[model samples]
Target: MTSLSDLRRALAPQPGEAGTAGGSDRPPLVVALPEGRAASPRDLRGWETKAALAVGTSGSTGDPKVVLLSAAALVASAELTHARLGGPGTWLLALPTGHIAGVQVLVRSVVAGTEPGVMDLSTGFRASGFATAARAVLTRPGPHYTALVPTQLARLVATDGPGLAAIREFDAVLIGGAATPPSLLARARAAGVRVVTTYGMSETAGGCVYDGVPLDGVRLRLNDGRIEIAGPVLALGYQGGEPFGEWFRTGDLGRLTDGRLEVIGRADDVIISGGENVSPTEVERVLAAQPGVHEVCVVGVPDPEWGQAVAAAVVPTDPDTPPAEDDLAAAVRAAVGRCAAPKQVAYLPELPLKGPGKVDRAAVARTFG
Candidate 1:
């Protein structure tokens, strides 16, 4: 078994190359973490041959830790993805190179013997920038693919002109990083964007499950009301934990029925409110469908009456015009039901997302408290 120290030694760059100015000294290493789920580690010298990435969880729902993976696992994942999407295509690095999804784009390109068009992420993800970058890259491209988080996908779909136009031209867009609201996917699809919803984390080497089905060599099962994953795509294990073999236990509460996986959010994130079990992902999904709610997150706040009351944080589509809370609540209750609806709705100019394109649910919970 490859130890964490062994991985670090194998992949991290040589000593002389480590401090080079602006060199690929720190080529991103993908890591799947317990809290953040997927991340791109800054150092890769210790993992040069290590193809699988272990991402750290964002801790929006709880504490975070590292998960390990292998190169063979990554190859297995990418191969399955290529088969599912017709075949591997030229990829676009639109996201930060420090996350599993973003790193997979780079790794997939390498595996396909193709170079990906790199996008500048320092200024944050902008629809206009995406248009400009894509237009420049697509000028000399073949079949193209890009991976994006739900927040980025929502913005591109909402934007008119070049933004949405660029998205439509992509052969495929893999959306993951978090639970993508159904409404957002519908909007993107309505605008003629080919969106493939993804499920998998760093432990799975980016995304092992596309849409609802596991990729080649990947297996999914529900153990004790929680998601349990196995197969070649599974990560080695966390840094100091047991060597992961057979099945890696996932904190996510989910069930498999008829070979389809239905995610019900993290077990720790679920809130018992007013004698009813509420999954915040469900509420966020319903609220996202409401008008003017461009991005949304639901958190359970301490309530005297209901053990933990539901509250929502929203980023409206129109910055100048915000919707009324009552109307937003009404929409969610109507869509998801009053029993599962948010008790309070708060609007913000933007959701407090950490890193590029991922929502920071941890920060959202703090704001409500």
Candidate 2:
């Protein structure tokens, strides 16, 4: 099987003009990893044709699917990103290369004509280990950059030392993969970190928006409050002709104001409880603000009375002394309203994670809701 290390060779120019591959109908090249669930790569003949990568999503929301990306799509995404984050010079591969975010790092490095630096992530992400890797790359020539999830960014922001400093040194540090709380972003900036909150998914090759602004050649629109995206970075479609039109309709719900988008939450994540629409994300945001509430997820549970009752699965700061149910409920009610407040609260040691860092809402409902 071919490895991701052969990306440059796969894209090596033949007799074609710039921006297009030499010959059309060339078989798709799969970038295989030495290990992982997709470690044993099989030939999907003629799948990509002009594409060189096949990255599987973590499928935090539902069933995971493999997204097909073309060389033009990945190249466009990388160029757009570099334009926004200062021309790419050096990048640290702090994420899993099997995923789009990490794969884009290597692709961006290839386009920048530089080598992408990597850190060992198999042992679990750690601030100390991240610090060492960042230090090694900081000494390299030219500007530096890295991409990370909110959880990793939170760890670096909470701790002090080389990890925090190394993070601050980067020309840009992209935070995505899940919704980032405002408090976390504020804290990172307060600590002198250049945190750029990105919004996109494997379908878009990686992140196509920088801090609520869409990248050039990218467009965002709302269809009955659902987010729809159209851009050059759009993936060809899911495997087996998933049937994508011009615009990709995202499952997210959002609203636009003054030409900027404000993503509320997932469209399906809305809960109808007692005749009122309850946004679990809104409830979780308020509850997370309460003291002792570390991480929180709100879901709807079957209830004879309300049809679907509000339920909260919380990860408390101190498992020994979990936050009082009454206090947590009061906080949600205070910030949102009584209708949105969770009727039942389950305090767990930690929240269940899917893929990278997204909370597994379905698992949370099955276990606690």
Candidate 3:
């Protein structure tokens, strides 16, 4: 998969290029170059008509490779999203268009014949600004939608008046990139916000599952507990020519109950300590119930005795009054089992994230290692 860092570079502007959309004050509107367009004639014109811009995954696992997504596949994904979430109207472009999720936001709006309202992504996300920008966009009087990561959703849900109110006004708000803390989602829903949890990646052109079920024309199954995907939205192949098979084998482990897919965790994330299988996602759910945790990630750290021991990294709700490490650990044991409790808990001022607000696993591992 293409490294996210290199994809970041491709989205970077040419020197001295003026910003588009709401020019000068806002970031340039990054558009996907149309298929068959190239800078020079001799630069593989035969593939130009069918080739796509490759996006690299963050090499959290190993060396990054490029993932090829056809323009047709992207539009198909957008169509699924539009159909599932009612017909699309206008979109609030608050995310970087370089990423597939953000790019889909723009494409969906365009395909629906609506010009998306742009948000400034260079500066950090703010609850107040989201309210302001969204209100400005909705002034034309049409259905509107926005996509956010968990961190952004947390901030919005915390705001009493403007932010929460603004979110409630949207047609729908998609939460993805990482798991949304249940408390955050509950609070937002209580405030009358329409929130939908999305699951998918660049290979699927963006989110193909809303809540738990696969979108229109999408197929999902578990191969020995590992998630396997096959559908119209599947990408053609990778940039370096790693071709896709009939089904895409995802590294994630999942289960299907009553036809709904539940992501358990990454297969690589499972730790066998003392001959007991421990899932970090399970630990995270317990930690999320604690009083002071704003965000958390649980991972296995190298252990001399157990081979790998459960460890947790947390961001507290209050900077001054963080939860006691022991108390949080006890809470996890109470919620789950004693064996599931985190062996070590570390406090973080903030979790390192990529794209919008997804936790950067590689960055988190770097800290403890």
Candidate 4:
């Protein structure tokens, strides 16, 4: 794992340096590696020379890509975030450093000139450990901030312990990396947690959209239902793909309601069942609101009659007393449509996670198979 000191040095602007655009004296790209992995500055074929950091995609949906982000982009994102969150203060590193969310925390710390308190995830995320880290961060300064995924938030909210109380003290807690269920968000806020939903990817320097609003200098548009982002916070390009033009087209589909972006599911994740397109996100949203459903993930599976069938894997609030499959299917049918109803429902102790907080749809689909 790259140390915060190393990242701060690499991201800091050199003397007499203007910006990264069209610069010959660009810093070498630093690859953010996961824990237990080693990465050194070296010449990588096809990578942009002007790039400052190379972070790997989460690979939750499919094959991962190596996203090249410039120092200018990272700084722009961090500054805009602090501006939106009132001011730059101490940050706690809860997520892994290899992912964009984790890298952004360190970048924000460097930009704010504050040392960030790190969390130990060697045995995975625990509420007790997070409470301890939160206490350590709170002792430093005012307006402390942290970022987390939906899965982590779910755990924190579910457990009524020091974790929940400690998190309520932060100025803002950013939740991203995957879709946060409406119920979960409402539950957190009702419990005094100032939860802010975020949307973006490694291609856009972690998150450029907070609480459905684009940050300063970020622009959002819908090209045939697909979300496209353009701003200084955008990455240079993927390692092997074509460089981004004025706008970087995102794979996720969304719609604008009163100038606010509301993300639908991925365009490729639409399940075509009986000649009808069923959005898994729509189904999941409806099912998530139902009683006893703690977490849920919907996916399309092969079916002889419908060509594709909707299947759901749910983690109930209580494993011993799970929700009824018929009730969950009925909720989806009422909210979405009959075609969107899950033909198969599996109750599990926990949903399978791919990267960070994202659910592994492929793994869930395999459960039905």
Best by TM-score: 4
Off by over 4 Å in 3: 1-49
**How do the residues 1-369 of candidate 2 rate in per-residue lDDT, one tens digit apiece?**
234456665555535634533355343465533235554243444544445566777777777677777777888999999999888789998887767887888888888888777888879889888998888788988989999998899878877877898899999999988888776787799999999999888889889988889999999999998999998999877765554567999989987787677778988889899999998878877887778876788889999999898999988778999999999888888888888989988888777877657788888999753
- Scored against the true structure, residue 336 in model 4 reaches a CA lDDT of 89
List model 3 lDDT by residue over 1-369, tens digit each: 123233333333333432111213222222332222222221222232243344445444555454556545666787788898888678887766555667777667756767777777657788888888888777766678999888888888875868888888899999887777777788788989999999887777788889999998999998899998999888766554556887999888988999898898889888776678888888888788789888899887788987777788999988789889888879878876777777877889989886546677767766688
TM-score of 3: 0.85
Candidate 4 — which residues are off by over 4 angstroms? Answer: 21-27, 34-41, 44-47
lDDT of each: 0.73, 0.80, 0.72, 0.87
Worst 10 residues of 1 by lDDT: 18-27
Model 1 deviation from native, Cα RMSD in Å: 6.7
Candidate 4, residues 75-178: lDDT per residue as tens digits?
99999999999999999999987889999999999999998989998899999999999998999867899999999998898978999999999999999999
Model 1 Cα lDDT, one tens digit per residue, 1-369: 112333333234444443111133433343433323443454534333243355564454456566555656656677778888888778878877555677677667766667677777778788988888887657764678899998888778876778899989998999988888888888899999999988887777777777888887788888888998888777766665666779978889987878888898888888788888888888888778878778888888889999988899988888789877888778777877776778887788888876435678778888876
- Model 1 error, position 39 (Å): 13
Q: Which window of 10 residues has the lowest lDDT sum in candidate 4?
A: 18-27
Q: What is the TM-score of each candidate against the true structure?
A: 0.83, 0.91, 0.85, 0.96
Q: Per-residue error at 198 for model 3, in Å?
A: 0.3
Of 1 and 4, the candidate ahead on lDDT is 4
User: Can you list the residue pairs that collide in candidate 3?
Assistant: 1-65, 2-56, 2-57, 2-65, 2-66, 3-56
Backbone clash count for every predicted candidate, in the order shown: 32, 0, 6, 0
